[model samples]
Target: MKTLMLILAVIVGLALIAGGAILIAINRNGPAVLDTVDRISGGKNNTELLHKQSLGVDPRQKLLVYGERSPDEALPVFIFIHGGSWRSGNPDDYGFIARSIAPEGYIVVLGGYCLRENGRYPAMLQDTAAVTAWVHENITDFGGDPERIVLAGHSAGAYNVAQVALEQRWLEQARVPAQAIRGVVGLAGPYDFYPYDSDSTRAAFGSVGVGAESQPVNHTSSDAPPMLLVHGEQDSLVKPRNTRALAAALEDSGADVETLFLPAMTHNDPLLALANPWRRDPRIFDAVTSFLGQHTALSVPVQAETP
Candidate 1:
């Protein structure tokens, strides 16, 4: 009887240890962990880390360039915007994405923009447009093909990128041609949430008034670039309906659009997967790379220098 009790106690202890480790892995800041590891490793060995550069005057406006710099030959570029509910988040938080995708022969640009506290509604949109304009004029210097730039983002950043891609006003205001953007990739974005009930929503979109102009779904047009909309099936923060609604609108407008709904993913899971490639759902990377390849000249893989 005592032997039986001892065995049960051992089993319970092992279960508790496993459970605690799992919680720590999931709850920890994945990007911060990667950043710390990269720093300690003397990041010079990582091509992605070595090629990172900042653009624009504000500290918030930065870009992480990936791949070898080839001034003569312009390479396809991907500008990724980070998400923090339009309140917090920086380009540095998404270095993992650039690190993962840059080796595939594309110049990944992780861009940062103003948040709600700086300005609301069109403010963030305008910031993104400015970044696009900068990329169009100067990306060639960084081995990026200006003509084949793809805009991508997650959550609030997705909303910003979608708005900039769908509506021409912001780009026009920034003196960037509407056709400069070749494609868009959005993850768990809120495209049709209106009648704001939450403080965060009200802080960003409430003052603009609940109108069709404020929604990305209402801004879709046939002229808009091809889009890949990804959403988590279990996403409770933004809901899967946002992806469905945007897809429907884009299709209705005769625009090229694709949608992917991953099972058992939450609002943050997709980004987390990008940071930790070994985690659940490698499909996010596959779908993004495949989609970009189909639309841009990113099919060729670039050779990374051995560290």
Candidate 2:
């Protein structure tokens, strides 16, 4: 009887040890990270102005505002969120991406949020939703229309944006309707955080398990806003399958979803091309612009300069 009791004690001890290790991994931050990706990203520009605005207090989030201010022009707004695997990315890293979208007559806001190391799942999502609420309430002062807001982000940012759009609880707390969101775009984001396998992922995310309900795929419904999903065909970091799964889910629910799979690009290349406008591909811009135009009645009017 004593031998059996000793064996049970050992099993209990191992379970406790494994549980503690998982918690530690999930709560740890990756590294300090930091971007304005508004048009005129990597190149010199004498025209566009960059400004910083504080979005909140008590773990304050700062937003980078890039665009031309006008007295009579009420422009569309693109609110950008950056991805760092939930632990390491900074907002300024996506400035080039912001710049490419800004020239299309939108006020681009490249913004930051508290990460998992600082907080956790709902905390990061709350920070994003709060900043977005501030934009809806105050962006017109910067020459943007509150009614024409578009949320765009890469990787984890994409997931956050998708959650806010589908879940609605976050936006509702801020008095912003989910339908007020004109569009949402995710670039190679892990929308489904609850993983079935990959103990590392499970360890990193903790008890918030993955399921269809946890993924953005599970939230698709007829009333949801239109979506644009951009994924690199060769992106192994997040897997192109992630976007494919989401696209299928959205289509199954009758939501307007579009997927653009880029060739010869990886996770970082598409974002880099935003600042190095010379590297920008016409097809990418076309796909995004087409979706935005269809939903928002806005046009880019691009005319090739070359003879």
Candidate 3:
């Protein structure tokens, strides 16, 4: 009995310590804490932190590049936008995604957009388009192939990328050619949530006024780029129905689309699977890499042979 009590005490102590650490991380660093946790969980990786710089006056418009390449070697680009319900998060917080995807023969770009004080539907969309446009104009300096740029995001971010790729107007407004976006990878995104009722949806999108125009599902076209939409079967947050609806719309429009409803996965699990060490299972990572390989000129598998 005494031994059992001692073990229980130790377990409780560890739980308290962990809980406190998490609280501190959340309070001090916001969602950037996930980047630190992902790095720790990933153990060791060869991914390099290539650059950290702001593209415009808004601190939220910062960009972080990840991967190793020669001064003039141009590799296909994969840009990931961090999700925080369209109200929070920044590019640096999603380095785990860059670390996971960059080593597979790509230059990974994590982009930030206006949020909280200066964020809303159109503003966020415009910022995302601007990031793509900026990458197209200057990514060559960072060893990225502008013509093969791909867009990806999670949650609210997923909506932003999907809208930018599907709607066309956002990229057009940013002065970026629509074809410049080769493909899209969306993780648990809300593409058809109109008549907003949720706090986040109402807050981020209410200003845009009522209409299906903001929904990505309404913008599918035969000329739309190939897309991969992933969702958790057990997800209650965004719901797998969102993926199904969007995929059906894309398919009906004669657009290339793929859907993965992962069993037992939750809303954030798809994003968590992108962490390096967590990728040992390889299901989510494999799907993303396969889509990227199909669309990009590299056609390389997830595992790039080392020299």
lDDT of each: 0.79, 0.71, 0.86
Tens digits of per-residue lDDT for model 2, 165-245: 888788999888775699998888776556545443454355464355556777778878899999888887778888888
Off by over 4 Å in 3: 1-31, 41-44, 298-307
Give the Å shift of residue 64 in candidate 2: 1.7
TM-score of each: 0.83, 0.77, 0.86
In candidate 1, stretches whose alpha carbon ends up further than 4 angstroms from where it belongs are: 1-30, 34-46, 49-58, 208-210, 298-307
| Winner by TM-score between candidate 3 and candidate 1 | 3
**Number of clashes recorded per candidate:** 0, 12, 0
- By TM-score, the better pick of 2 and 3 is 3
Could you tell which candidate, 1 or 2, scores higher by TM-score?
1
Positional deviation of residue 79's Cα in model 1 after best superposition, in angstroms: 0.3
Residue 206's C-alpha lDDT in candidate 2? 59
Residue 72 displacement (Å), model 2 = 3.4
Greater lDDT among 2 and 3 belongs to 3
